[model samples]
Target chain A: MYVAVKGGERAIDAAHAWLAEERRGDASVAELSVPQIREQLKLAVNRVMAEGSLYDPDLAALAIKQSRGDLIEAIFLIRAYRTTLPRFGGSVPIDTGAMTCDRRVSATFKDAPGGQMLGPTFDYTHRLLDFKLAAEGEVPAAAEVEAGTAQTPHIMSFLDREGLIQPETDSDTTPPDLTRTPLELPATRDLRLQALARGDEGFILGMAYSTQRGYARNHAFVAELRIGTVAVEMDIPELGFAIEIGEIDVTECETVNQFQGSKTQPPQFTRGYGLVFGMSERKAISMALVDRALRWKELGEDNLGAPAQDEEFVLYHADNIQATGFLEHIKLPHYVDFQSELELIRKLRREAEANNAAPSESAGASGGNLSGKMKEGAAE
Target chain B: MNEKTDPNAARKAWLSLLARCSAADLDALWTDAALDPDHTVLRTPEVGSVMVRGRAGAVGSAFNLGEMTVTRTSVRLASGEDGHGYVQGRDKVKATRAALIDALMQTAEADAIRAAVLTPLQAGMEQTRATRSAKATATKVDFFTMVRGED
Candidate 1:
């Protein structure tokens, strides 16, 4: 007789109680608020917003706090909450070209139209220990300038003017929404980009790194990276004009990959694109690289069989929620299967020893024959 | 194109203004109008969310950034004019009022609604923008360099 493991609910409740205590960590330290996370731990909030595909900073901060700063857990919380909300009609595509840039830079040109404004960045900061930050930190106010009226010209535009880069045809077709539909094989560029946008940041980063390290090596150069706010507009059918609805912060990345001329075409630079919510340049750049690598088929490049190049492999495993669920489920009970395997291995060992000791004796015995038949049936 | 002759263009501007107006402003406009407009709720005010998307590099393919809370409603005027309203945030009353205004604008009440609701809302929005810009300008700094006599 077997008694199954019970009291799981009570055990889970106790574990949760302990977890709450552990999350608090220290009594003297003050509790962190949602506003603090939203303002100070802004990058973490941005990541949750980007991967979760939801934009509310306040809700993202709350999720971060509830998940105890585990970003993937926060993203999972956001995604779960997002699915429950009713859908409103979609806004018209935002004009990124008209974005009021706060931080815009280009690596492709020596001096671009928008003079490389290195707005608040950690790129130049020395990674030295700051003991002052551990106690009470004070930040000096950054210099201010009138917000520029001119839209920062894209670096790729210059390349396009020279006929050096491939030109993309304007598309009027509505892209498929993965949230509404089941993911099918051979996803469109739009669908692939959507998966990469909300994909696990670290997983996409690793895949991008693999491409740089000889697998589907595309020799990517950062053509342009811009972080700014753009106005959202919705077209009213009754009224002939579209009107501005709201504004949101976004980060956009465009990478110019290696140039090549196919048999019929002239040499032209290819492009990789990435766009994410808030100021997440790293994710944007990584997404762009991975995006370009996945476009190998459309570009008529040979299938180098790179992980980044495999659309099915990348899109299917990109979602952290699904990946984590499958990974964590191994902790569940499997004792029955383990016990069966154990018995079979023991029986096999016994048979081998019996055959070695007295092969003819075992072969002639009716009892041995019956047992052997039962073992064979069990194996089958 | 003259806005006077273009009813569609003028209506769009008014609708957009209503969508952007604060809940209090919308209410004040409604009360101040003193128009006992008869209307039926075709669709009850519903609170929902929209997944806002952005194009990569502004011209590339679109990607979802996040969701924003919105309230929407539809109403029909007694005269059979239909109107709809969609606004950011979770204000049901504001959304309903907007829909009412939308319907009335299409009916014979267009001029009266323009004078009562649209004008005040537009003024309020412009004031808000001006105040924000003025505050932002106070912190503006311009960098310049002077040539020295030594040079």
Candidate 2:
């Protein structure tokens, strides 16, 4: 009779105790506060908010604190918490044109309606580390401008007016929520955008990088990139109007790609759009590039078999939570399967030795050979 | 009273008013008697998050910014009146009080609520806003130059 591994409960409890102690390393040091993480590790909080698809800065901060600065783990905490809350209703579509922009720029135009306001950016700064910044230093206030009602006109609108760019038609249909539904293949542009919005920033960046390296290369010019706060409003049936619910900061990017003229339509510059929660220009720009690449079919462009252009591949692998879960699950027990494989390999070797034959059967002997062939075929 | 009106507008106004009310004041405002009518919780007060979005640039496309915590509740009065409340933060009692007030405002006690709750809250918010604007204005710097004698 074999004694079962019944001490697992005690072991798990002890491990948890050890982990809690480890989390609060060096009792002499002050405990990290949620507000500190929210303010100090702002970029990390921003990433958790962006990828987690939840916007609460406080909760993101707390998640960071609890997760011990592991951003992906913090994002998982937020995402899990997000599923528990009941949705009130969908908000009225906000007007981006009415945004009070903090940082707005247009690479396509020498001069745009809102003259490039590069507020708090690292664009022109040298990469040299400022040692003094390690210590908390008060930042002097920048000049302020009176809030104005002048709406910023989109660059694409100008191109659209001149018939130089393809017009995007508005749809009143509600988009499918990925959170509530299982992902299906051949997703709509709306669904694709929704996925890309909450997709892993690093993964999206890599995919975008691949496109720039000549795989489905579309000469993309940053038509405009703006980061600012916009009012969120919801229609109240009782009030007979929509009222501003709140405000949040966002980063939006639009890329103008090379023109494609078809038999029925004249050559017009196509566009890619990206909108993410928070001040993340890199993610937003990358998302736009990937968005454009995925639209190759609809844009009447040749499918160059780029990885970014593969909708199924990109959507399925873009989520870091799912990716990490699948990758990490490998640490779990697979002893039974491994034992069977070991037995088979040993039996095969024994048979080969006894037969005294040539190594002809070696090619077909492995269990993974067929799958390897299939993987190659699929890649092609 | 001849042409009946939908109670939605009144409810929305009160809810919005309650949302803007100071959180500290809300604790003091909670009274068991003010929630006079028998009501059943349509939905228990629970905390959740809403994804705040913004349209940052020239394009009218909205983008996700992040989420904020909101506590919400709904209650139906015994007299067939329904009230809802949504407040920022995880304060359940505040959400409940707001919901109760919403239900009460829809009834004949609308005037009493307006006098007791709405007016004071609105005045307090206005005072806060005025004080903030005054502080901001005091720091405003105006730059001008006299005509240069050399020019």
> Number of clashes in every candidate structure?
3, 8
lDDT of 1 by residue, A120-179 (tens): 677778988878888876677544445444446887888888989887655655667888
Alpha carbon deviation, residue A313, candidate 2 (Å): 1.5
Candidate 1 clash pair list:
A54-B66, A55-B66, A55-B67
lDDT of 2 by residue, B18-65 (tens): 765656776554552354568999989988765554332233344344
Error of 1 at A180 (Å): 2.4
Local error of candidate 2 at A114, Å? Answer: 3.4
lDDT of 1 by residue, B1-151 (tens): 3578775677677667777777888888788877566888888998877767666545755655456667788999889998888776678888888888888888877998898889978898777654543333333323356778894
lDDT of 2 at A117: 64
